[model samples]
Target: MSSYSNDNTTMETTTTREDRLGYNNNTLKIVVGAFITSVAWICLLFTLIVFFAIFKSGQLKKDTINMLATLYCWTTAIYEDSYT
Candidate 1:
């Protein structure tokens, strides 16, 4: 019985070490993927909100250069989103 208990303890310790070293775990990958996806979504939402706010303020219409720049930025943002 003592030998069995020792074997169980050793197995638990090895598993704990592997987990600490970030080996053999899909859980970490899933967590990192979730975090990155949430951040990307937040960035996309923020960009859209800012774009609408600028549009509503009439800044895009008043300045031709600014309008062009805004459009360029928005295009690049969309491109980046698709790329990611």
Candidate 2:
């Protein structure tokens, strides 16, 4: 009976260790995912701001290519924001 009790205790200890390791792995994944998402958002915002500056400068007001590029940038920003 004493041997059986010792075996049970050992099993419980092993299970606890496995659970703790799993929790740590999950936390690491969450942190990495958040970091990637933040970087993506920052890039998107930067692109939007750059294009906005160009659009507002009025130097390219009569340029068709500049207008198209500005429109594309705004559309992309709106589309990406919608998914979030």
Candidate 3:
């Protein structure tokens, strides 16, 4: 809890000595992890869409495309393995 007091000269802010509830290190870590995961998923989806468009347009080199696909597979595999 907090309160603000004012006098003719200045204003003072005060809070309770008790600790705040419902938030801690684990909560912070979970929130950060969720945010990162969401951003990563969005980026991954965007990249895939762009890749598909480029593939269809036949502008990408076959070797580089294959390497990218392989890297994506490895990344997915690692993420799944780590999470599960």
lDDT of each residue in 1-84, candidate 1, tens digit only = 123356456422234566668776777766776666666577667667776887788876657557546765765565455434
Question: What is the total number of backbone clashes in candidate 2?
Answer: 0
Q: What is the C-alpha lDDT of each candidate?
A: 0.62, 0.61, 0.65
The sequence of per-residue lDDT tens digits that candidate 2 reaches over residues 1-84 is 112356456322234565756675667767766766676566667767766687688655657456656766765665555445
Name the TM-score of candidate 2: 0.48
Report the lDDT of model 1 for residue 48. Answer: 70
Model 1 scores what on Cα lDDT? 0.62
Reference-based TM-score of each model: 0.47, 0.48, 0.52
Question: Which of the two, 2 or 3, has more lDDT?
Answer: 3
Least well predicted 10-residue stretch by lDDT in candidate 1: 1-10
Superposed by TM-score, candidate 2 places the C-alpha of residue 74 at a distance from the truth, in angstroms, of: 15
Query: Which candidate order results from sorting by TM-score in descending order?
Result: 3, 2, 1
lDDT of 3 at 31: 72
Candidate 3: count the clashes: 0
Q: Give per-residue lDDT, candidate 1, residue 64.
A: 52
